[model samples]
Target: MGTSLLILGVALWAGAHFFKRLAPEKRAEIGEAGKGAVAIALLISIVLMVIGYRMAEPVWLWIAPFWMVHVNNLLLFIAFYLFAVSGLKTNLHRRIRHPQLSGFKAWAVGHLLVVGTVQGLILFGGLLAWAVVSVIVINRANRDWARPPEAPMWKEGVAVVGALFLMLVVGQIHGWIGPWPFGGA
Candidate 1:
């Protein structure tokens, strides 16, 4: 049942996201209302995914070494940093076309490395695939990309600091919900 719910959530989430790309005419016809509907579906899918993942029985596929946790942390840092840079006017933003999606890909891959359970694989793998496809589709859709103005160095420093703060907060939340990221420290 949990697995089924998870699968359904993934399908709904992916479908809603891809709907615009798949049916641009339909999306345009719906207009702003379509965005709201998609947002609602995305919210519901997130809730379902969380509940389904927690409810699902763990079936270990492989054992990840303890060292992988460190690597996961590093990836997470990079992910968060990218996410922070995405919102800001940074020079990195000009170089990385899809900062948020790239962050998401990194995050999903990091989680997949640390979590080897069946549910983990299904959830993280699905997200990773979605992020990859999104990047590809978006790139294809926008062939001639215009470069944005570069931000100041100070702003980049601020983004890094903000990302670090966000990471700490996320680590705390992870500790509250599941295993502590820093080995229960």
Candidate 2:
């Protein structure tokens, strides 16, 4: 049941997100109300994902070597930095068309390494797939890419510092609910 909920939640996430792009006419018909509907759907999806992940029984495939934790942490750090790049429109943002989606892929893959369970596979893999598919979908639909205005060099430094801080804070929060990521083997 938990796995089912998790799958359903992931499906809902994809559906809600893709609705705007896939059904522009319908979305336009709904007008401003569509935004609220999508937001509510996203919130429900998140709740289902959290509950499902917490409730699911672990079925381990293979325990990751302790050293992989460091690798995973590095990937997560990169992911966070890329996320910052996406928002800050740093230099990297021009090079990377979809930094946020790339970050999402990294984040999902990082988790996939440490979590060897079926539930982990489903959650992380599903999200990874979603990110990949989203990129393809977006690329196909939008041919022209307009780069955002160049940001000051200082903004890059800010992104770096902000990413580290974000990783620390989010890691701490994760520790409260689940496994402590910092130096935890």
Candidate 3:
């Protein structure tokens, strides 16, 4: 059940984002629902993540190389930093229009490499796969989209500060929530 839910969540997240590109009209219709549909989808995804994480049993399906952990952590950190940069209303947003998606892709792949639970594998692996494909498709499709060649220093500073704030939040969650759906203190 938990595995199924996690898969469903992955499907929802991936499908929602992808459909926006594949079927612009349909995506617009859903988007016209005034953010409610988006919010609902996000809510469902969160619930699925929580339930799936909680119900997942820690079983080693495959052994990751020792160096992979450090690499993955670094990737996750970079992902978080990109997400922070994307969230800020800085020139970074102008320079990197899809920083959030890029960040999520990195974060998902990093987790998939280290976290070997069924739910984690399904959710993160599915997302990582989608992210890769989406990047390719979006790049090809939106090649004509204009972009800024460079960002201002203030934007870079905002990205740095935002990353630090987000790092603090992640630490707090790790400490208070006790390692999320998986019991790891």
Give the top-scoring candidate (lDDT).
2
Candidate 2 lDDT over 1-185, as tens digits, reads: 89899998988998999999899999999999999999999999989888888888989998999998898999999999999999899998988999999999999999999999998998899989999999999999998999888889998999999999999999999999889897743
Q: lDDT by residue for model 1 over 59-95, one digit each (tens)?
A: 9999889889988888898999999898886899999
- Each model's TM-score? 0.96, 0.97, 0.80
- Return the TM-score for candidate 3, rounded to 2 decimals: 0.80
Off by over 4 Å in 1: none
Model 2 score (lDDT): 0.93
Question: Which of the two, 2 or 3, has more lDDT?
Answer: 2
Local error of candidate 3 at residue 163 (angstroms): 0.3
**Which residue pairs in candidate 2 collide?**
none
Query: What's the C-alpha lDDT at position 109 in model 3?
Result: 84
lDDT for model 1 comes to 0.90
**Global lDDT scores for all candidate models:** 0.90, 0.93, 0.74
